[model samples]
Target: MNSPDDTHESTVCPGCRAVLPSSRWPETPKYNASPECAEVAGELLGFEVENAARLGYLHQLRIDAYGGQHVSPDAPRIGPVFALNGLYMFLERGSGNLDVRTAHGIMANSYDDWPRLVPPDRVGELTAYDVLIAGGVDEVESALLKWARQVWESWPDDIRETIRELTVELVPERYFRR
Candidate 1:
């Protein structure tokens, strides 16, 4: 067995398929995660939590973007749907006005019959590594937004239309005027 101190060559994440350094942790089967990708995700989560004050409004956006990219059929169906809708609210709506509680309620109520979504073959080129490497708050925020946009656009055309339809159906009309 490889010890935590042992270093190995790069491995690919099963979720986003990003080539990443081998994780110190041994690989164990997960729904849509691998050791390396999980390690990077942990690092990004740490950064977001540590710098939540500096991250401000972008915190949820970053989380949703990452979640959207890493979805799996074995996971809760709401994961991808919620992430996509969150991205749509923030990116397409031009204002992050969709209340989280309202969105959650809508999803819980309306999405029970929705079919499970298959993750795209390619999520996005940028990963959490890109945001983590950005030196300062401004740089990190920029990187995070860029990554979110790319991930949002990476979904299939039909899936994106579903996101739009869901948003229009669930969100309050007033939120869209802005």
Candidate 2:
């Protein structure tokens, strides 16, 4: 962990209780050891798990999704864009780390499990914006699935078919033509 003086110390991971003495960077999630724990970390932070498994691949996919050319000095980065109750999300880490924005921003990203405790329907006061801001191809697929589900049984046949075609574009080679 980092202190105001730029000194570091061993800190316990909130998700797995691991001592992150050698973490590459301070504020990096403790669940780096396993995909499942990574998911839990996001869950504990009131964020949805997007592209948890095979994160390295997810990182590449995010870069490809954003149209990349030159890679940064740092290797891979995990900028999982997690939605808060099927709504707004922290889009990306961008350069380094994120800030605690409008109390909602900090509250939404905090380690406290407050959002999960509140029923999604009861929180009508919170404005919901429908933007995927997918961080990777898999995340994009998941978003499409979610959108389809919301419009299912009522949406036009052509729109549903269009979404299906888009999803097909990202299917891995091994899963293609099935």
Candidate 3:
């Protein structure tokens, strides 16, 4: 019988389909007894492949909306478009745009066009841009929808709009360099 390590194939780079060795994956912190925390942690870490893929789709959509390229093949290597829950949510920035595995692709977003309503204090060590350009369109929509349908559901319609206007595209601005 195959061991747990051997039972499943190693995770490969979704962008390039590069076969990732077992050693290449991040060493997650040890798991405790609580299955709840483990599940939460996995969700947060983009370990859930389906969820990640959804988020990645959203991320790409947002980039495309901003006139950014979907995939920049020619740009120098930056890194893989991140996946969470099997979704491709965020792409690494390179050549002043989203870096795709393919060659000659250059994608960029208009940072200045984004609103600056996010509080400087709440921004913490991260900037407005950092939070905006981080995830794919689907992931971001999921997060926004979660907040809208769950936590902010009871909020006034105007309030919901206000909150979303500030936080909706947090990834691109947050991650994309000026």
Q: Can you write out model 3's per-residue Cα lDDT over 54-171, one digit (the tens) per residue?
A: 5543433332221111112332222111111001222223212233212212222312232222111111122112223337655445543332122212323453354334322434
lDDT of each: 0.75, 0.27, 0.28
User: Could you tally the backbone clashes for each prediction?
Assistant: 0, 0, 51
TM-score of each candidate? Answer: 0.84, 0.18, 0.20
Candidate with better TM-score, 1 vs 2: 1
Candidate 1: misplaced stretches above 4 Å? 1-4, 25-31, 95-98, 174-177
Q: Model 3, residue 164: displacement in angstroms?
A: 6.0
Model 1: per-residue Cα lDDT over 1-178, one tens digit each: 1347757578777777877777675553433767777777667777777888877578668778878888876777777888888888788876452454367566677657565777788888888777887878788889999999999999998998988887787767666534
Query: What's the CA error at residue 112 for candidate 2, in Å?
Result: 40
Across 47-112, the per-residue lDDT of candidate 2 in tens digits comes to: 223434433223322222211111122323211111121111112221111221222243335433
- Could you report the Cα RMSD, in angstroms, for every candidate shown? 3.1, 17.9, 15.5
TM-score for model 2? 0.18
Best by TM-score: 1
Candidate 2 pairs with clashing backbones: none
